[model samples]
Target: MLNLLGLDAVAESVYRGILDRPQDVDDLCDRLKLTEKEIRDALDRLSEMALVRPSTEDPGQLHAVSPHVGMEILLARQQAELASQKQRLEASRAAAAQLILEYDDRRADAGSAEAGVRYLEGIDSIRDHLAVLREQVVRELLTFAPGGPQTQANMSASRPLNQQLLERGVQMRTVYLDSIRSCTDTMKYVHWLTEHGCQVRTVPSLPNRMIIYDRKAAIIAAHTENTAAGAMQLTSQGAVTTLHALFESVWQSAEPVVRQARPTPGALNRQQAEALRLLAQGLTDEAIANRLGVSPRTARRIASGLMDVLDADSRFQAGVHAVQRGYLPSTPL
Candidate 1:
């Protein structure tokens, strides 16, 4: 929809009318059944987007650019913005990583939790902190739930809070692992979230478990494999802002949760591509399974299937064939 490209319904309708034939303000108002002011406002927006231009024959009139040209312009602009955001995200990730390393090195020497970071020990402590933050949220909540499929206990415990937030009209966006598609209970909970106005999406993997409240505070897992081990609550502006940017980058690239998560025609699915990447790096099945949040057996099955598709006799051969077939953009090695 044009809304995805930042065009509202009224503006799109006005552009369509103008595309049919060059139109003056009066003509657009008559054709669209909109008031003169509305038509003029749409024209102003369309003009700024370069979707509309002044008519050559009648300077007072405005004309629509061809649909192809207009759409290409919009797409190109969006692509550039996405690329810039990605760069910022990468920089933020690097900076955050370095800062965390530094903080960890000095924590014992300086004593107490470092500025901008609070160490939360145990699951209960993390949950209690989240409860307090939940009550304080005034706007949006962004989360990364990377484990393959959520546990029933966790989902059940979260529903009431989720419902209250939805009722209060706060925006909630969550990203989960793509492997969740294989879990009925997880899918059911995802459907419930969507039905109640929360947006959910899935990706092949996530960096860690995280929940950012209002983009001003965030809690990130201390251990990627065992989040319950501990967590760090971050409140520093620079760190929180960086994590917020990271979430936005991931969210924009993630696919919405649906009945099926399909790959593009003749291309590898995200999971398979990620597996191939890891395989190329010579990771063991257990390691790959850990990263993917899947069982070792499932990881082996996926690897075997990929080998069969590539007509490869070994994992190394599979990686080679994947590259030759353009399944991978060259091995990370």
Candidate 2:
């Protein structure tokens, strides 16, 4: 039925009447109770779409074509259009791929030449390059992450890459915002990583999310602006070294996770104290969950409890309290 073709009710009726029996334009208009102009316009469109045909015997008579023939013609046109579209798509993809390759090669060449810095864009491209560097991590891995929307989102999406590094025995040391210590999902992921021998730590300071792999390659956010969503991967020895030094300076001041023990004496009841200790050390809620063998949400709740106890407004405040209480005497920032 013409209704099935998304035609209006009057148009469908006119089309069905004509298809059932060839109709003169006047009869089609009268039978369908439509104006002459409306019928004529519908018939013209149907004809153009190859859904209707003109009677050879009478110029004014019109007949609806077989649905099969209409479908065949429609399919043929669609196939042709799809083929053209595919060609264009392939051309575009090829051009984009070539541009990426050229950019990467040029970046490498520039690194060799000690030229100006290069920038990379998009999450997919960044992940792809990071996966390659992760494979090349032979000695050590260090990361600094400040909990924010973007960093958390990226970490969630980069699960496979993290698991891959763990499976390959890459030594990973990650520092995160003490605030993350309260996030349940982050804690579970941290537990997963630690179970596989990755060393994780926490610190109170807000260090931008950064990753240094094997002291030879480093990835850092280009700016503090949230508007930009890209990271810069530094491969040049000098740049990497500088980042490595910065990482180490922060790492040395970070609180190391004590994997072998639970909360120390009198720290259990004061969940805020424990939470403060963990945050000041830079453990995410996920890491805290794993460390405490608790659910991520529960770990976060405990952190919240700690916050309440300290009468502190933020994780940073709680961390400062822990330091003031001498929980972080050994690791001074």
Candidate 3:
């Protein structure tokens, strides 16, 4: 049961045996029916993990650390490791973005464009490309509108094009953030779009904004923090197919906006569950906001609420409590 904390079967048995009563290697072997060698090995491993310490009064003796203290030590180690991993991931993202930019530059200098991947900068360029694609697309449109609520101007501007597409028998499906449920105008626009024969759904969060035209090409935000800065238009079969799969995966679990979705019994709601997962990943409120398409304040509130619910004093503690309560998987997802 304590395996998640780095304890194996023998180590856990040794821990339990010495928890309240410090046991020598002989006593442990006698109680656990293990060899003296196994008992000593478990003690050494436990000591290295800070779950057990040598007794000062008896040089050959070992005692288990308090359960609470041991757990805190293990949790702190996990949290540190998570923070390091998060840093590496951030660095990798930056590196990938740089490589894309360099590759695009090389293509531009060659005076010929690749057929598969192309980069477009500025809002006007993206809009122009979308307009051209809209006129040409014959089959379907799949989009992820990640930012929480649409602006009135954008909604008004999109209505005509959306109506035109729908009138031409295009299949349109969009997924938006669940936070839009609280925005009156956004909900009204969603209702209007639904009435116009578009299918719309909501999820707890989205990775980024994306639009796929006829499953042949996809446009994704070039900069996660500022979508207006640019976009990457991918026509590569492999990339487009992968994105389509991602959309389908999210769509299968998303709830339609026309009705409220019920949560599983004894489980956190999707939003809270997602928030806790992000919190455990060592994300800042701002980073959480970017993923969830909500303000940082909103992200902080959701995280704080989760901590309170778990009766945890810190983010890592919240994660530990969540695991203990079966709110999160023993192994991080």
lDDT of 1 at 121: 76
Identify the runs in model 3 with alpha carbons over 4 angstroms from their true place: 1-112
| Highest lDDT scorer | 1
Better of 2 and 3 by TM-score: 3
Model 2 lDDT at residue 189? 73
lDDT of 1 by residue, 1-333 (tens): 476466889999998898898878887787789998898888888887889989988888887899999997665444211112333434544665565554432321234345677788789998898999999998999999987888989899999999999999899999998788779899899989999999998866677788999988888887777889788887779878878887887787677885333233345666777677678767899988977889999999989988887899987788788879876556232
RMSD of 2: 25.9
Q: Per-prediction TM-score, please?
A: 0.68, 0.43, 0.67
lDDT values of the candidates?
0.78, 0.60, 0.77
Q: What pairs collide in candidate 3?
A: none
Which is the winner by lDDT between candidate 1 and candidate 3? 1
Off by over 4 Å in 2: 1-113, 148-156, 258-333
Ranking by TM-score: 1, 3, 2
- Candidate 1 CA-lDDT value: 0.78
Q: lDDT ranking from best to worst?
A: 1, 3, 2
